[model samples]
Target: MQVVTTIAGSDSGGGAGIQADLKTFQELKVFGTSVITALTAQNTLGVSGVMPIEASFVEQQLQALLEDFSISAVKTGMLFSSAIIQTVAQMTANTKVPLIVDPVMIAKGGESLLRQDAIDAIINHLLPVATIVTPNIPEAETLTGKEINTLADIKEVAKLLLQTGVQCVIIKGGHLADRNFAIDYIFFKNGQSFSMQTPRIASKNTHGTGCTFSAAITAFLGSGLPIKEAIIEAKKFIQLAITYDLALGNGHGPTNHFAYQNYKETCEVIIHES
Candidate 1:
């Protein structure tokens, strides 16, 4: 079986961090491993507290995993501190495996997942090694110091992200003003770009959508799919997951991770050259 590792925070609510990532990896038929960077006291409502693990301990966990498992790909989520982000960057710098960096900055309930000081760490350390960096609009704005209000701005932000040394960038355009359709912009350092558009599913159970989407991409990449195909497939997986909502929590609930297995055949994703 293909093995993928998620280095992210642990959400006690089991919706939007390493828990969601593991669930996504399992559903996508990849063996999942994890090194938790922090523990979050959060539910569907909001994040109550976060306790970051020491950077040294986080490194030790990563070292143990690398010594034993041949991780095919690695995805990073909420690295809450600069120390933890730097440690992850250093540990994975030589892995030569596909690295999916999810710039997880804010929660759905408006709580900050990453520290302001750590944003620079991500740009300086993590992005340099990332195979693909996925950032939502707000996170992209924070990373690039530019606001995204139009399609042109989104494209500009994607371009700015490429200068960070990442092989590719996917800016999630879910926060775009257009609610009729949700679009994600994908750009590569090789000067190719594509737009993946889907009819937005109106649902509150989108708590782990970003984590699940990035995890799916990591899983597909580990299974030997080409990068473009991996990203398209990941988008389909997330669309299905969002479509078949489990509606578990009162606030923003988790997507149905298993939805892809059942509804993938019926799902449709549209991609166009940009």
Candidate 2:
């Protein structure tokens, strides 16, 4: 089986971070490995606390994994501090593996998962080595220091992000003002771009959407799909995950990570102009 690794935090809530990434990798039929960067005390209601793992230990975990497995792809989620971000960047920078960076900054309950100082580390060190960087609207704004109010704004932010040396950028549009359909715009450094949209489902169980979406892309990439096809499949994966809600938590619940695997045949891809 193709092996993939996630360098991220662990959520006690089991709805996001490493939990969501591992669940996604499993559903996509890839062998999953992980290096935990932090431990979060959280539930569906909210995050109460976070304990960041030491940078040295994070390096050790990655080193041990690198010594053994042939990791086909790697995705990073919540590197809470600049130290940990630097450590992860150093470990993954020279490798030829496809890297998917999920710029996870805040939780659904408004808890900050990334430190204010770590943004520079991510942009300068991590993003330069990333194959694709997935950022939501707010994260994109934070990265580019610009407001994103329209589709044109998203295109501009994507162009700025590509200058960071990432091969591609995916700016998710769930936070945009549109309430009808969820749109995601993908831009490649080669000047190719496209947007995908699906009818927005009115549900509260959307906690781990970004993590799961990026993890699906990692899984597809590990399984030998090209970047464009991997993203297309990942889009379908998340659409099914969100559409078939798990309804487990009191607040923002998680997407059904198994939904895509169970209903792959019927899950259709919707590409539309926003």
Candidate 3:
């Protein structure tokens, strides 16, 4: 089994964050573990409150996992503070596991997730160490200091973000409100780029899609798929998960994590002795 660790926040709504990550791992057949940085009192409506776990506690969780588990890949979401971001970056730097940094800066409800004070540390430290950073339109704007009006703008931002030392950037169009079309662009750190387009599904059950997308990529990489292939498969899986929507919450609902899962595999992830 490919063991994947998700270092992220917890969503009590059970639609986003670590909850969605574990579900995606199960659907992709990877063994999942997690280190929660914070806890959210959120629902379909929106986040009501946040209780950030101690930064030391977050570090300890990662320490325990790194010392005990054979984690093949890691995905992170919603690091709520500079302390948590710093801790994760330092802890992951010496490890060989592929890391997917989901720069979850904003919520589906138009609220900020990443603190402005922590933005500097994320760019200078955390983002540079990530294997890939998945950011939506607004988050990209925040990181790149440019407006994403066209596909060219999207590619440019991804390229600039790549220069930050992340292996690649996947600029998501999930938050595009134009309602005419939807597209996601992937830019490799090697100066290559690709775009995939799909028609917009008019569904309100869109919460946790980002979490699922990042988690799926982590899971695929854990299964030994190459980065591009892993991203492609993850994209397809997330699309199906969104297509087979489970109408649960009053606000944006959750995607069906098990929608396209039909096969079961025994986990065979192995670790080398250091």
Q: In order, what is each prediction's RMSD in angstroms?
A: 0.7, 1.2, 5.9
Q: Give the alpha-carbon lDDT of every model.
A: 0.93, 0.93, 0.85
TM-score of each: 0.99, 0.98, 0.93
Worst window of 10 by summed lDDT in candidate 2: 265-274
> How accurate locally is residue 99 in candidate 2, as Cα lDDT from 0 to 100?
97
In model 3, what lDDT does residue 211 have? Answer: 94
| Cα-lDDT of candidate 2 | 0.93
- Per-residue accuracy of model 1 over 16-77 as CA lDDT, tens digit each: 89999999989889999999999999999989999999999999999999999999999999
Which scores greater on TM-score, model 1 or model 3? 1
Residue 153, model 3: lDDT of 84
Ten-residue stretch with the least lDDT total in model 3: 265-274
Candidate 2 TM-score, C-alpha based: 0.98
